[model samples]
Target: MVLKESLLELLKIKAIANITIKELCERADINRSTFYSHYSDQYELLTSIEDEVLDELQNTLQLYNHSDKNETFEMLQRIFEYMASKKDICQMLLSDYGGRNFQNRVMSITHQYIIQKWEDEQNILKSHSEYVTLFVLSGSIEVVKSWLSNGMEDSPEAMARWINDFTSNGLSCIPKNENSRLK
Candidate 1:
């Protein structure tokens, strides 16, 4: 646990490629042998952390059936709540330093869910489903990144509602301001 926490902390400041085992060991307050016994290298340790999060995300996705709109929204809220609960690790892993692999993995986990939801609720064409899914997932990822970067002042429920509204209702769901450029 200490090693994983230490690696995540280091990731906040530097890329995984630049982080060395010695530094990680020092940060974790353990010797090189201890780290080596658990992970052969920094990348392995990082992968371990990513896998843990991915597993939990997959499990979370399973908790909701997505059979209805309300259930879908609840699932999204639950995901955001999970992210909030693991703020530090989520923030770091979703950041630039964390690399696209983790983000891609996350998208992969949620891809089927999003695709099924759109197909059932929106009646989206099968041929266009991939594009639509990509667009929504990309936007949702950016929203999560922004939410994490902003210290998550809003509650998870609020974030989930905004995301759901934006995706389901499009731009109309977002209120316009006179000073805003959307108009």
Candidate 2:
């Protein structure tokens, strides 16, 4: 636990590729042998942390039937709530220092579930589903990153609603003046 937390702290400032085992051990107040005994290297420790968060996220997604729109929103709310609960780590892991690997892994996990839901519930054409899924997931990830970066002033429910609304209605979900030129 100490080592993991220490690594997370280091990740906030530097990428895992740049973090050394000695620095990590010093951060955790442990010796190099102690860290080596549990993990092979910094990457292994980082992977361990990512795996833990991913496991919990996968379990959270499995708790609801996402095929239904309403259920999907609820599931998203729960996911945001989970992210809120782990704000520190989530923020760091999603930051530039966290690397594309973790983000790609997250996308992979959600992509499977979301694409399945879209195919089953909306009957989106198979040819277009991948593009649609990638667009939605990429935007959703940026939204979550923004929410976290902004200190998450909005409630998870509210964030979830915004995401769901955008996903379902696109730009139409935003209101505009009657005289607005763009229609």
Candidate 3:
């Protein structure tokens, strides 16, 4: 916990690329031995923090069982609320100072979530499901990145509704079987 707290504080003042193990240990009031006992290096420590964030996001998502539109929107709201609660971490990860790896990891996780949701919906796609999923995921992530970069000024519920509207509306354009219900 100290290491994570220290790293986040340091990230506020310096980019991840600029932070060093010695500096992190000092800020954390711990010795190098203690630092290395937990992590091989600074990058690994940062990655652990990212993993923690991802785990929390996943936990928030696991609360939902159904794939209905209302449930999906509720899930999105919880995700945004979680992110808003951890704005410091989210902001740091999304910032230009934050390495691309963190952002990519976030996007990858989100894409996986969307893919799972789409699968649950059992909707038909004109193209490969992977392509359609990627299209929706990537576009949604861009909108979220912009929201984060802009300080997440909008309420999480408001942002979630907007994202839900955008994604569901776009997905409606995909051709489907006449017998299938729109997800």
- Using TM-score as the measure, the top candidate is 2
Worst 10 residues of 1 by lDDT: 63-72
Best by lDDT: 2
Q: What is the lDDT of residue 16 in candidate 1?
A: 88
**What ranking emerges by TM-score with the best candidate at the front?**
2, 1, 3
Worst 10 residues of 2 by lDDT: 60-69
**Candidate 2 all-Cα RMSD:** 1.5
Clashing pairs in 2: none
Question: Could you tell me how far off, in angstroms, the CA of residue 147 lies in candidate 1 after the best superposition?
Answer: 0.6
TM-score of 1: 0.91
TM-score of each: 0.91, 0.94, 0.79
Question: All models: lDDT?
Answer: 0.88, 0.90, 0.79
lDDT ranking, best first: 2, 1, 3
Better of 1 and 3 by lDDT: 1
- The digit string of per-residue lDDT tens for model 2 on 53-92 reads 8999899888888777798799899989999999998998
* Stretch of 10 with least lDDT, candidate 3: 120-129
Query: Against the hidden true structure, what lDDT does model 2 obtain?
Result: 0.90
